[model samples]
Target: MNDEEARTRLLDAAEALFYAEGIQAVGMDRIRTESGIPLKRLYRLYPAKEALVTAYLERRDRRWMASLSAATRGQADPVGAVFEWLAEWFSEPDFRGCAFLNAYGELGAGPAGVLDVVRRHKAELRALLAGIAGPGREGLAEQLLLLVEGATVVAALEPGPGAAVRAREAAYVLVRADGTG
Candidate 1:
């Protein structure tokens, strides 16, 4: 394949392996094998495993935020709409909690770069929620973020009943209490 295709394949393999397993548990050679990309090319694309991990997170951040944005676009209540989006994400067959949260739990301290990416992704998400919440709703943003993170973790661990549904209900209460929805 060409350079672009090779890059995509490498990233695809890295994302799957890193998310399915932890970042530390997966190796560059395994990524090479999974992607079918040669070692030399893999090194050229991502000179170090840290770089690959960062890229995996960056790509996932973009895709996740974009999907959430699209799903909530032009809605009457974006904050509530966000919870709806989360419910769908929770229901995905391969739902494995928030990728950022999982990665942070695995490699947040050592790799500084990965932690930065995770923090930035979460900050951006909070910012999005704040914008949707409008002015004077700073507390609303914090509360909704907590609800989202809690629901994601709980849903991943015990997805039997109404984790996302309950979170969604709580989100609506917060939004309406803030008089924004």
Candidate 2:
């Protein structure tokens, strides 16, 4: 295959394996076997497993944010739209918690780059919430973020869904209290 196809295949494999199983648990050879790309080509594309992991996280961040963006585009209540997106994500069949959070839990203290990516993703999420919240509601944005993160953890741990619903209810209360609801 061509370089672009090979790179896509490699990253697809990495995203699947790394997200399903912890990043540290999966090795380069396994990625190669999963991707069906030759070892030499894999090395040429990623250069190192760290690079691959970084790329996977970066790609996931972009895609995740984009999905939320598209789902919430043009909504009057951006905060509610965000919770809607979260609820949608929480209901997915193979939903395995937030990828960035999972990565941090597994490798937060392992690599600087990994932690950087997680932090950046979260910061972006906060910024998005802040923008949606509008002026004079910075505190509301922070509380909403906490609710979002907490809902993610709770939904991941609980046997059933509706964490997002409950969090959204709390967010609504915050928004109304802030005069933005």
Candidate 3:
């Protein structure tokens, strides 16, 4: 494969494994084995497992931002956009939890860079919330984030559409109460 395709394959493999299996539980060998690429090629792309994890998070973040941007199009209202943006997540099959958050949880803390990705992803989510939530509601954004995470957790536990529905309802109430609904 060419450079771009190879890189994409490696990242795709990492995303699948990292999401399906825990980040810490997955190793470079498995990533290589799953990708059908040789170990040497994998190393050339990612020098370390941590770097691969970072790349996985980055790929996911980019996809997330793209989805959010596309889904919220023509809806200038931030809160409304957020609710619609969430539809993508709720609609997905096998949605377990936030991959970044899950990675952090599974890894049990690591080098600064690993945690940095989690923090950065979180900040991005919060910023999206703040934009939709309107002015002077940082606390509200954080709270809404918690609600989102809670919903994700519940959905993961319950294994049905009901959990997502509940989350959307709770989110509607939360944002509406803040006058952004």
Clashes of 3: 1
Q: Which ranges of candidate 1 are over 4 A from the true structure?
A: none
Q: TM per model? A: 0.94, 0.94, 0.87
Q: Please identify which of the two predictions, 2 or 3, would achieve the higher lDDT against the true structure.
A: 2
lDDT against the true structure, each candidate: 0.87, 0.86, 0.76
- Can you write out model 3's per-residue Cα lDDT over 32-105, one digit (the tens) per residue? 98888899988988888888898889889889877776665567555555655565575577576778778888
Quick one: ranking by TM-score, best first?
A: 1, 2, 3
Task: Please give the ranking of all candidate structures by lDDT, highest first, separated by commas.
Answer: 1, 2, 3
Candidate 2 per-residue lDDT over residues 65-140, each given as its tens digit: 8888777678977777888788888887777788899988887667788788889999998988887787778898
Q: Measured by TM-score, how close is model 1 to the native structure?
A: 0.94
Candidate scoring better on TM-score of 2 and 3: 2
Better of 1 and 2 by lDDT: 1
Q: Which stretches of candidate 2 lie over 4 Å from their true place?
A: none
True lDDT of residue 25, candidate 3: 83
